[model samples]
Target: ILEEHAFVDELAEREIPVVPASRIDGRTLHSFAGYRFSVFPRRGGRAPELGDSATLEWIGRFIGRIHAVGALTPFQHRPALNPQTFGRDPFDYLRNHGFLPPELAATWASVVEQALEGVARCYERAGELPLLRLHGDCHGGNVLWTPDGPHFVDFDDSRMGPAVQDLWMLLSGERQEMVGQMADVLAGYEDFCDFHPRQLYLVEALRTLRLIHYSAWLAMRWDDPAFPAAFPWFNTQRYWQDRILELREQVALMDEPPLWPV
Candidate 1:
C-alpha cells in the first residue's frame, strides 16, 4: 500500500493528474485491531466519455505522461504483471481447491489450458518487449472526469508491466472501432512517450490471462459474505461453461493479427 501511495505521490508531484491517497501524521497506512488501512480523500466525478474522440485522446495523453514518469525507475516492492502471477497461479489455485463444479471441471481445465497456451504464443511473438512500471489496472472504471479532465484513482494494482497493459482496457467494440480508438489514444500518447509496436501482440494474451484470473479470484473470495452476495452467479456450472466459451473465443482472437494504429 505504501509503495502504491508513494508511486502516486511521485506522479502527483510531477503534475500528472492522479488521486493519491492522503497520509495521516506522515504515514499513509494505519493499523487498527491488526487490520491495516489507508484513507483517500473523497472524490467525485463521472466516468470519462470514451466514445468521444477527444476524450480518448485526452486519456491517452494522461497515460502517456504517466508512463514517461513510470519508466524512470523500477518498483522494488511491487510485483510484475506476468503469466505466472496473473494466469498460472490463479489457475492452480482454482484447480487445487476443487472450486469448479464436478460436471465442468474437466472441460474448464482443458479450455483454460488451451487459453494459456495461446497466451504463451503471444509472448513468443512479442519477444523482448519493454517492461515498465504501469497502472496495471487502467480500465475506464478507474478514471473519473470532472470539468477539467480525467483523474486516475486506485493505484492498488500498480505493477511493472508493458505500457500497453495500461492502454488495452480502454478499447472495445469491433476491430475497426478499436483500431480507431487506438489511433486516437496513440496520437496523444506519443506526444509524451514512444510506443512499441510489438507489445500489440500481448493485448489478447493479457485479456485471456485476466479471464482466467477473474474466475480464480471469485472462487478464492467466495468465503467472504460480501463476495457471494455481490457475485451470486460465480462458481456456478453456467459460469464455468460461459468462461470455457469465452476462453475458446479468446484462443481464436489470439491467432488473429495484432491491431494496427491508424
Candidate 2:
C-alpha cells in the first residue's frame, strides 16, 4: 500500500495528471474513504477508448517519460512472474487446486525450464542494463481513454524491474505482432528505459509461461459440467500444446542470438 502511494505521489510531483489514488494500509481497496486524494470526473461518463493511433502516440510519449522517472528512482519491488491474486510461486498454488494431473504438471515445469534457460542467454547477450521501476503489468485493459488522453489505472502491480517486463505483456495475446501499433508504446517507454531484443524475448517467454501456467490453473478450478465450461482441462490441454509448439518454433529461431539493443 505504501508503494502505491509513493508511485502516485511521484507522478503527481512530476505534474502528471493521474487519477487521484492512494492506499489505506490494510484497508479495502473498494472504499473511497481510503484514497488520499480526490480528483475525479463527471459521474457515469463513458470510459475513454485507447485504440486509435493518436492515442497510441500520446501513450508512447507518456511511457517514455515513465521510463525516465524509473531511471532516476530504483524500483521498490521485485520482478515477479505471477499476478497478486494468484499468490507467489503459482505452480505450487496450481498443484494444491486439485485440477492439474501429473502429466500437466510435468509439461508446465518443462516449459518454465526452457524459458529460464532462455533468460540466462538473454542476460549473457544484453549484459547488465539499467534497472527501472515499471507498471509490471501493462496489458490493454489497464489503459483508459480520458479527456486528457490515455490515463493508466491499476498500479497495484507496479514494481521495480526490467522495462521489457512491461513490453512483454503488451506484446502478448492478440497484439503479438501489432509491433507497428506498439512502436508508440515502445517510443513512450524508451524515453526512460531501454532493453535488448534478447531481453525482450526472454521477458516475453516468461510472460507466456505465466499464461500457460494460469490457464491450467483456471481449467482446474472451472472444470465442471453444471457450472458451464470456462475452460475445461481437455480444451485447455490442447491449447497449451499448441502454444508450446509455437514457443518451440520461436526458440528454435533464437538458436542464433537475436540482434540485441534494438
The candidate that wins on TM-score is: 1
The TM-score, computed over Cα atoms with residue i paired to residue i, of candidate 2 is 0.65
> All models: lDDT?
0.90, 0.55
Please write out the lDDT profile of model 1 over residues 124-213, one tens digit for every residue: 998987788899899999999999999999888899999999999999999989989988999999999999999999999999998988
lDDT: worst 10-residue window of model 1 = 253-262
In model 1, the clashing pairs are: none
| Candidate 1's TM-score | 0.97
Per-residue lDDT of candidate 2, residues 104-160 (tens digit): 656755664565455455556566656677776666676666576666666667766
Q: Model 2, residue 168: what's the lDDT? A: 54
